[model samples]
Target: MSGYRVGDIQLDEPVSVLPQAHIVGNIIAPRLRVAGMVYGSTAAHDTIILKDGQIWGDVHTGRLEVAAGGRVQGWVSSLDSADYQRIREEGVVPAIEPGAATAQDLPANGRSVTRSDAQNTLLRRLQDEAASALAARVELEQTFDKRLQEVAGETTARLA
Candidate 1:
């Protein structure tokens, strides 16, 4: 990809992805004009998808214009009118700032979980469940083995 950034990019003005350019990350801006391909979502006050332009992720904007041959593969949701105007006037999203977000600022409902964090959390949970299941299986096997041995001993005694 030509304009692939490692993380999200925030812009104060309108941004355009040129015809030959492709971006792999999310974009945050007042407006976006795409003439190329974007692999990630976009949050902007206004978005125009030119001919041949494609977006593989969700688009969140107040106004969306798509020319012939343009395409978006994900959901498109219009932003609140007030928030759209505020971003245009302020040059930034109202609820988000340009700094590191603290834990307190992040919600607890897993909305802000990164890919790695989610993967780690899932791995740990699966491991714990697997261990518990294995322990239960072992206990069940032991109980069956002891019962079988007792039955065998009684049968032998009766025969003798």
Candidate 2:
């Protein structure tokens, strides 16, 4: 869509927001290409592409591609291919019942976990997040190269 403002968009198929479009709430889509601005969360099963777009909240995606001028100011969590496939098949992440057991509350084998362990766990999680972000940037560079190659090929084909 073009030149529109929306709130809380959810999609089961592919969707794209053209440049200058603005979305004020969450978006859930199989594949999403953002060329505008999104002020809230986004979850994509296949991929999330930001081409000169801006996002101010969390993003959860299978694959991510951000162009040179694109900007994101919040967290990004990448799902593995298997997770993406599952999401595609199920249409949404599995529902976690309220008050479900979590690492913070439960210890493996009922062992007593301490505050130090929690701090260490947090540290590790942060470290992993940093690594994931770095990996995403690397993947973006690789994707850019492939895109450049495709563009060159198209140009050559047109000339021929």
lDDT of 2 by residue, 1-160 (tens): 5544445766668878888766656677778888876766677865455667876666778778888889775656777767666655655443222233445676676546434645655654664465456445545666799999999999999999
Q: Which structure among the candidates has the greatest lDDT?
A: 1
Runs off by more than 4 Å, candidate 1: 1-6, 81-160
Per residue, candidate 1 scores C-alpha lDDT tens digits across 26-94 of 788888999987766678988999999887666879899999999876557679767666645554433
- TM-score against truth, every candidate: 0.50, 0.50
Q: Predict model 1's lDDT versus the native.
A: 0.68
Worst 10 residues of 2 by lDDT: 93-102
Span of 10 residues, lowest total lDDT, candidate 1: 92-101
Structure candidate 1, residue pairs in collision: none
Q: After superposition, how far is residue 104 of candidate 1 from its true place, in Å?
A: 36
Clashes per candidate, residues 3 or more apart or on different chains: 0, 0
Q: What is residue 29's positional error in candidate 2, in angstroms?
A: 0.6
